[model samples]
Target: MSTSFLLFFALAGSVVAQNFWFSFGDSYTQTGFLDNEALPSVANPFGNPPFPGFTATGGPNWIDFDTTTHNNSLVFTYNYAFGGATIDANLVAPFEPTVLSVTDQVNQFLQTVASKPASTPWTSENSLFSIWIGINDLGNSYFLSDNRTSFDTTLLDAEFALVQQLVSTHSSLFDVGARNFLFLNVPPTDRSPLMLAEPASAQAMLKANILDFNSQLVEFAENFKASNAGVTTLIWDSNTAFNTILDDPTAFGFIDAVSFGTGPGFFWINTLHTTSPANVFWAEGVADVLEGTIF
Candidate 1:
């Protein structure tokens, strides 16, 4: 086992139970967990294929690392992320028709876990809801003929609208006491191997779209927190975290920033996705946020 895994186990004496994590996102966060599958248990919190479930990173993704390795407390993770999910299919179609969008994921949560069922008993105080979407939404539309500015606005409007629905008084989650929320911004995908192969102008456009989307996301999060009472909101700036590694890959123990391979030193595992080490860094950062251990 890795040192981090051993460290997590060693800290079991301080583990606090009943801390639930409801995660929703795309490939970067997917862990192939199904609601009907074997539910999470103390021995195996993820409770599906195995410890490091099917992931796009070629190993464990951020959700897997956060739940098992980086977490300070024992958290039962219910990940509803799919491989090609967008914010909403109506606004931005996924790579596959069968893929469930973030909207679909939220609806799934409402139907299955929102009511505080007997099988997965979760309370608002002990549970946290997180969404790390918009990668596909912007990637699918950034190069399209549609007006980029207007389309980005439409995407975020729909995104925050769903957030509103979750926190609304009439919503199932609100009635069942669901308060904590964490929103992760889109990472610096323009620096990915796929985008590195693109033209300079194309790369610039994609970067601009990412920055705009992330800026609006912060605004929405601030507004949501200001307007909602008794709600805890956090925005994890994943873009900066990815850029920090990309800027100095060797500092993070990566051989280089632009390489793509299924190896320890490579920063990326594929053209568009990062390696498990990169995901581990992300998980550690998020764990710090959740544990209030970072400034």
Candidate 2:
């Protein structure tokens, strides 16, 4: 084999040997992979119900695409995202009480995977923990008559508090040797079909809140990295990605950017969620971030 081909195989082998991704978020990132269900294996990476699992996109969501399509390695994804999760149910309740919040998901991770059990042995160097929340937290509270700016502060405080808990040395993911983290900021939900139908002022308010949250999120991540030693952090700007596709749907193979349907032509599957094709683009973007091709 040529030198270039040999290098490719070497890198591929390293990736295939060890790559575990732990995902946490809401509807946008949910894949319905339960701990009680079947565990992830090489034969069936996603486990449980199948490749796509139960998703909001009407097909495979970003998690599925990331694992199967964008990944150059054999990645076993352990997803703990619920459909209507918020940062904290006490702060902003989910659509249902049973829906797991970010707090609950982290708790679940501690209870089940913190010990690095034999069934899923993952190391700090080989595993990645990703969290993509804040959409529901902001969406459910942005329209409240209460002081919106103060609410955003309160929400991020609670959200980052949980993040601190996760990285703390006592009984947490960091204690279990997980050092890599990828935090995805809230996407442009204000441009979704649901928000588009709202009054222009309402849409503008939501967009403002999103921008505020994303800016604060960046500051928090920078501070977090500064405080924590031996930890790697990455922030993916899903907002910009959403806007890029929405601005030019044709460039991304979508017939309509402002419509919702089950067909591939529509960017969204419902009033609030994007279609699988859109998520494919998201997965690709995430892959780029992971490969260090983009910041």
Candidate 3:
């Protein structure tokens, strides 16, 4: 066999060997999940063309890249993320009422577990559950107020609450025999185009809020691990990855590193999202960090 074929087999083997991958979060992690419900062809399981969802990349998002191209083909990918979802809807709700909140997504997973088909089964050893949220939660809060002290306090409490919910959700997932997990924290939203347009003082406050949220997230992960047994978890710091790219875009192979647009060289697709090129970079960073942990 040729070298390319051998390499393909190696990568495919890694993916097929894993039990299942279930992703839960907002648009950043969404890939037309609900659209899959109506798709006839299982080949493009994510419902790409007619149902691109709200992927900022203008194409397959990271989850799509991992389950489809990255893995060659995934055994199964149950992505339950909505474009504007939040951990708690009361804290932040997507534009559509049908969008599943983080809690709702977890509940849906539980329902999926209960009604799983015989052809596709899940096991604790091979299954992976990942979550990447909190941007909207912070975004809504930031937009609601400009007071640094109040926003900071409220955001921190919300982060703590989210972690607590995760602990409970993981316990339930564990009961159903899901062990491996990956958690991606919030990135630097303050640096995004929309936020960048804000006054310097507001921008600085937003950055500080993100830092507080991420710090609390780390602590929550530690607590969750301590409380649970035989569960392997990896928290990918997306914040650091984003910052690194912003610090030196050329190093990561970008042309218009400073500009924000949909064209070549630009990073930010809008004030709220990154371009496809930047998404690829972000996806690679995530894949690299998950190297030894998941595979």
Candidate 4:
């Protein structure tokens, strides 16, 4: 066979040896994306996306994800998420790398899925897939506005359309074909680093934007399921996830981490991402959702 065929077979062999696990999206995935290193560029300082005009110490460097668990997973897995990326960034303007277009992102997912050999032991049963992007699309605009009007109705309508397109296209891969799909929802941007450091005046303006994004997210997910049939997409709500401890930190059993500032009830290494315990906790949430369903 040709050299390309030889390499393909080698890769297939590796996949056959381990289960199939794939994760996609931006910074949320970045904790597990950057291959165990922190990304200095496209950083979110305050802990998640921010509110309008709320500036922070610097760009986000969410480096506290549970790499040990992410890295430990031996499956033929890869994280193709680029920081500063948004759900609609595919159709709208680009964010960080802008080089890899939105279509390119989708193709990356397709290629990874296609990479698995039909004869591989992992099958659709134990395979896992996840997509966790969408905050930046709305958060970036809100952070720039410094006012409450960022919740422009026109923009939100467009956002919903973008969500529809993403789900529709991605669904084809597994909607009726592949196995389990972990579809993540938007985490509240008001709690992001940008909003955290901003003045109350500016924050008051962006609150609506946060609401818009969340509303659009809920709309999209519900609409998707309502419109489609035989869909097995799972939603991971960091909004609800964050709310659990946002009001009461001690409940989650958090410790203080200087870099993350005051405290979100846990040690956030930085203003934005989670510390090791938190990272693993987030991972566990994903893992739990993936429970026996994977096997």
**How well is each residue in 1-295 modelled by candidate 3, as lDDT tens digits?**
0112124445743533423677788888777666325431344444344434557676657765565444432335667777888777766666677778887877776655523446346666556778898888777775566564555555445644544443344453344555577788889988887887889888887788788777776776677667778767788888988899888888777664346766677777777877776776666766666665433
In TM-score terms, candidate 3 sits at 0.80
What is the per-residue lDDT of model 4 for residues 124-180, given as tens digits with 9 covering 90 to 100?
555555667656655666655544334444444554443344345444445313445
What do the candidate models score in CA lDDT, each in turn?
0.82, 0.81, 0.65, 0.48
Write the candidate numbers in order of decreasing TM-score. 1, 2, 3, 4
TM-score (C-alpha, index-matched) for candidate 2 = 0.90
Residue-pair clashes per prediction, in order, are 0, 0, 3, 10
Q: What are the RMSD figures for all models against the true structure?
A: 3.1, 3.9, 4.5, 10.3
- Alpha-carbon deviation at 32 in model 3, angstroms: 0.9
| Clash-forming residue pairs, model 1 | none
Query: Which ten residues in a row are the worst by lDDT in model 2?
Result: 1-10
Q: What TM-score, over all chains together, does every model reach?
A: 0.91, 0.90, 0.80, 0.61
Across 1-295, the per-residue lDDT of candidate 1 in tens digits comes to 1224335445756654556888889998998888878877677787676878889898888888877767556678889888899999988899889999999998888778788778788886778889999898888888884467677778888887777766665453347456799999999898889889999888889999999889888888888889888878888889999999899999999999898999779889998999887888888788767765211
Q: Candidate 3: deviation at residue 188, Å?
A: 0.8
Pairs that collide in candidate 4 are 43-60, 44-60, 46-193, 46-271, 47-271, 47-272, 50-195, 51-195, 147-205, 148-205
